[model samples]
Target: MMLQDIDAVIFDLDGSLVDSMWIWEQIDIEYLGRFGIALPDNLQYEIEGKSFSETAHFFKERFQISDPLQKIKDDWNEMAWNKYSYEVPLKNGADSFLAYCKANDIKLGIATSNSRELVMNVAAVHGLEHYFDCIMTGCDVEKGKPAPDIYLAVADALKVDPSRCLVFEDIIPGILAGKAAGMKVCAVEDAYSEAIRAEKKELADYYIKDYTDFSSLY
Candidate 1:
């Protein structure tokens, strides 16, 4: 992918910018267990690109959960906090890629479906807060991935045209979202999304196994 005309690089946090996708599945299993509900096989697929609040609502409605929305979200945050802080790490070579963008005067931003609190905490833990000019959660906008809202909002916040922004995304909805925003989308590889790898490549403008693939470009 050429960076010649790109003014900003936007990332989807969970599987694209960091190795935290596994953490969510674990949280789902444990969270649902609390209500004595066994996780459905297609639960992840059903909630693939939903925002944090949307997911909480899904659980409430689908599982007939009695807890208020905020409580469900709070429980998830509490369960995932320690894992995100200590166990999760940046994607391979992501730090170098971020520094490369910074050195080239390219703006950086995060457009994620995660909650703002969790996203901010992850950024703090990874020392990534300084690298991003904007950090937008899906709930900040009216819609989440598969819609252009979050990515468009991030570009707008950065004062960059969507056409000049390049987006790195891991899942199908996110890749579609970036493209829908008119940004060049790069499909990133992640273990969690391996099942649909071919579709991701077909949908995105570029495909990369990891940030290390950019080494040849620089």
Candidate 2:
């Protein structure tokens, strides 16, 4: 009955479904290092929930870098592609959880702030592309997490009512986004968001430390 009450499930890709958040941190270090700019201590937390385009703009403005916004995104994508394609692994129990959703006939969607090319690459490499009925990137929407645009778009793509959707997210902004879209959100635990775990729990409708924990939902 619980499963029946939810028509669709949406997941965030990075920290929520895969263990690739560290890659971005390292990339930031290296990218800024190229300009002899040391990354700010609070930069990661500040930009944790921003869309790909927004993050690129932030880097250009904050660092006073000469690169165009698109160029910054392209360079970061280039640096990240190989790692996402080969090194990133699924979060604990993600495989089984996705299988469960598919077997249960739950409409599955992915709404991510990552680049479309990289998202497809990672999904294909992990064999997750088949599980998603709809996979939308930040570029597909006008705004990103905390703005509700991406999640709303995914819900539309899946042809599901936002009120009947269940979202799994790792960051506070993402949790806020799902809630703003009128969906119930489960905050997934990720080491990248450790500092804000308590905050996430407060913001989400439910809190799950791992995908296996969803066993109770059945």
> Which candidate number maximizes TM-score?
1
TM-score of each: 0.98, 0.95
State the local distance difference test value for candidate 1: 0.93
What is residue 178's positional error in candidate 2, in angstroms?
0.3
Per-residue lDDT tens digits of candidate 2, residues 1-218? 43558989999999999989989989999999999988889998788678899889888888899999989999999999999988999988888888988998889999999988898998889888789999998878888888999999999999999999999999988999999999999889988889888898999988878877866654
Estimate, for each residue in 1-218, the C-alpha lDDT of model 1 and write its tens digit: 45879999999999999999998888898888988989899999999889999999999999999999999999998998899889999999999999999998999999999988889999999888899999999899998889999999999999999999999999999999999999999999999999999999999999999999888756
Which candidate should be chosen as best, given lDDT against the real structure?
A: 1
Which run of 10 residues does model 2 get worst, by summed lDDT? Answer: 209-218
Per-residue lDDT value at 82 in model 1: 94
Candidate 2 displacement at residue 184 in angstroms: 0.6
